[model samples]
Target: MTKQTDSMSKQVETNKNAGSEHPPVKEHYKDSLEGSENNSEGFLAEVKAVKRFWSPVWIVPILCVFIGLWIIYEHYSSLGPQVTLTTSTAEGIEAGKTRIKTRNVDVGIVESVELSDDFSQVILTARLSDGKEDFLRTDSAFWVVRPQIDKSGISGLGTILSGPYIELLPGVSKESNNTFALLDAPPIAAPDAKGLRIFLESDEYGQLAAGDPVLFRGYQVGTVETSAFNHETKKMKYQLFINSPLDNLITENVRFWKDSGVNVDVSAQGIRFEMSSLATLFSGGVSFDVPKGWSAGQKVANNTSFRLFNNRTNILEREFKEFDPYVILVSESIRGLEPGAPVEFRGIRLGTVIEAPMNINDEQIVKNDNLVIPILIHIEPARFTELLGEQFNVVEQYEKGNIKGLRASLKAANLLTGAVFIDLDFYPDDILVQEKQTFANYRVLPTVSGGIAQIQQKVMLTLDKINKLPVENFIQEATGTLETSKETLVALNDTLHSVNQLLSNQSTQELPAVMKTTLHELNTTLEGLQPGSQGYSSSVQTLQRLEQTLRELQPLLQTLNQKSNALIFEAPATVDPVPKAAKP
Candidate 1:
């Protein structure tokens, strides 16, 4: 066999060198037989098995395996992180269709939507794009974005046509998370926004809500991020964010008050109308500022707690710290006096009414016959500091005033509203009590009956006095006098009737003609005395003659007097005296 193989190999090499396809089978067999005969010692044929490193059949399977590996790498490389999202409701979410976005940029898609184990919530498995896994921080927020109209105004309007999607707000926390709870509403402020966060507590919830604007001097500077009510504390707590530089304005002494947009103040001064803005008018907001007479204190840090007042006036009322408390025992009814009533000194507010008609048990009421209603009031020394100096001691001043007959009385503040306030003034007429008085542990400030109560009391006293009088007897006497006057009047009427009858007689009627004839004769007689009439002219001539006669008689009378004197004794005629010069 070896000799045959060598002969065949030699024949194949000769064919290959000749560049021929093959040798004839008969010639190849003859050559092989001749080579075998030439080998005298016929070698044992050694049959060696041959093996191949590879085969053509393996090409298809290897190509298929490579293709599968490439496909698997591509599938895994393209996939991002998977996160589980939980929400109360699956309102707008859909499996494989819903997308997650941040700042309106698509970032992920919901792979599946399923119910929680208790079926109380919707769970969504969302797949984010490559490298977006970093956004899944512990504090990250997620919510559905849809058309919403709220107190803040219209938002998510674009989602109306684009369809609802999950909104993701990346948090600042370094810790990563794969599961998160969905928010019902979008956050008021961006997580990364520069601002200050604060907490406010209020006794009442008021009308404030999340997304409400926070105003500084009527200008928006922040927003209400969250609002929650505590069942245990019974207070409404609010989380607020003041933007950037505006946050610097917040101080320890600053006040926060609810802005119901429109402020209508019906005070003793007058009705004042104030509005923050048109936007706030429809949607209520909050306002902050340092209250009047208060100093802006140090800047507040994050999460600082503060009190939220109902209104600006309430904040001002609470700003004073240095004050003294006293009680006023009022005998009159305190119908219009309420807590927070102004305690004024001659129309200037010096204090606030802490309580009207202090709480008293039935036993106390029964024990005291003349039970005067006790009014608790706080007199702030700060109010008088400007006038009485900062060193003024409220208690000292109160004691001094008490000794000098300073008293409190209820006065009508607004007649239309029937509101009353405590008035402080000196009333010397009130019975003086030298001893200090106290009621319910509070120093008593003497009170006097004044205002409407005094008037009512006086009226009641007058009515009582009148009631005590003999009114029936007075009425009877008045009736008797009236009857007598009626009789007198009847007699006067009879006299008048008789006079009328006398005037109505015929002679009485003809008296006018007789009087007229007399008047005519008198006129003729009077005309004779006139200068232009005969009587007047005669009188004038007679007077002239009388004057001439008197003039002629004057000389005769003088002569007669002189002759009579001469006859009585040697009548001497007086000679005319001549002027003479003074003797030298």
Candidate 2:
């Protein structure tokens, strides 16, 4: 069998070298085997084909490796690296296929995120961009904060996912390094900042939660974080957070109270106060007050973790310091009243009430409780409100000489209702304008007022007393006076009556005859005395002669009469009755 196999192998090798279609071994076998001759040629052809197929096996392996490398390169160059940017949150970001680009050039891709071993931060595995790895900076800051802006301002978050990023802040120097430092993600919300913590003892907070406002001078500068009762002290505690810069303005002298809504009010000098706003309407805030000419501002020492301050008081202290303010509280006595309530001086509202009570209650000295009321009022300084007025046109009013600075007064709010509001005004009767126009500038004025109701009552009572007086008494007194007058008149009347009676009693016939005889005798005598007849001429001549004779005789008679006058003068009449003034 060995000899035969060797011979056949030698023959097959010789056919392959010759490129013969049929090997010698096959022809030799066909000669010995008669029946298998038809299959021999086919078998030899197959063997030749098998030998040719061996050469390509090494080349096939080489070709397969080349195709594999091409595929890997295509995916790596286009898809970039798989990088994960871990942040505090993933709210606004996409994972997995999320891309990270440097200068808009794709640098990496997000793969997946997982909690780090320490659980302090999230770990992200990202494949770096191919050779484009200079985007990471060492000093760049990263935050997961979202931008919030609404009448306030804007903030920033490092990643688009509302999550923090491992920001690479590059140094100015051109340097290169290979190590990585894991970073911490920013917090979702910051811890309590430095601010005021108000301790309130109230049961008014039912649905009242935090995020409420704390206002100062009409401006909102802070928000509430929580409202709860302190078990230790049995009081309501409110944790308020305010901006850091403004916290320094608070002081210990400030007083805080819940404010009620503002309403139209009156003050001295016909002044009207106007109030409006939602904060004032629903939930009142705390306010501050200070003494006139006193400074409520001071340097604040941040001794503790937070500093508490009152906003309204700070505002009032700053804005109203140029003017005056009257301090007054709202109570049951101040119902239907409000801030800006009139501080009327005379019939004018010179100022207004600055505040009011939302609702308040009171109990008996030792008994009843469960009381509720509507509103109360608070007055600014009388002088301040009166001077400010509604429009606050101080410069114009000053020019008119109607008022000047602060003065305390009890002014009637309304004449009809007779409600009263106390305030100060500028009508300082005689205080020098540039000198003592302000009450704070001088000694406090004494308060005085006969209340309108009291005065009106007194006047009405006087009228009623006059109306109620007895008419009979008045008539009796008048009659007494009439009687005295009648007595005086009676004497004169009696004289007239007596004379009238005497005249009336006289007989008219006798009076007429007597008067007629007297008139006739007087006429006869008068006629006889008239000069001018013949006998009268002769008598005239005779009278002239007698006149001459009498003229001569007069001297002698005068001498004799002188002696007689001497004799008469020597003896005065003794029997003559003394003349007396005649009596009626």
Give the residue spans of candidate 1 off by over 4 A.
1-78, 150-158, 267-272, 319-322, 361-368, 390-395, 398-402, 462-584
Tens-digit lDDT string for candidate 1 (1-584): 76567766786667768876433634666656676776776642332324689989999999999999999999999999999998889997888888999988989999999998899998999999999978999978999888998765788898787789999999888899999998889888887899999999988866588888899888899999898999999999999999998899999889898888789877543466777766578878889998776779899899999999877877767757677888888777888777888888877778888887777664243214786777788988777776667554434665765346677788888877778888887766664653467766778777777688878988999999989999999999999999999999999999999999999999999999999999999998887777688778888899999999999988768877768664357656679999999999
Clashes of each: 2, 51
lDDT of prediction 2: 0.48
Residue 227 error, candidate 1, Å: 1.8
lDDT of 2 by residue, 1-584 (tens): 34544656677788779887765555666553453346444322223334464565699889999999999988777653333344444443344655444333445555666677777756556665666444443322233334444323344434435343333333333343333343333221133345644443443443233544555656666665556776775556655555566665555444443444454433222434545356656654543334445567554443222222322232222223343343322112443344445554444434444544332234221212523222222222434454555455442344365656543444455665545565434546545433322221222222332244356678999999988999889999999999999998999899999888777765853788899999999987666656875656777899999999999988658656656675345544347688999999
CA lDDT of every candidate: 0.82, 0.48
Q: Which residues of candidate 2, in runs, are more than 4 Å off?
A: 1-189, 192-209, 229-236, 253-292, 299-449, 452-457, 465-584
Instruction: Tell me model 1's lDDT, rounded to 2 decimals.
Output: 0.82
By summed lDDT, which 10 consecutive residues of candidate 2 come out lowest?
A: 437-446
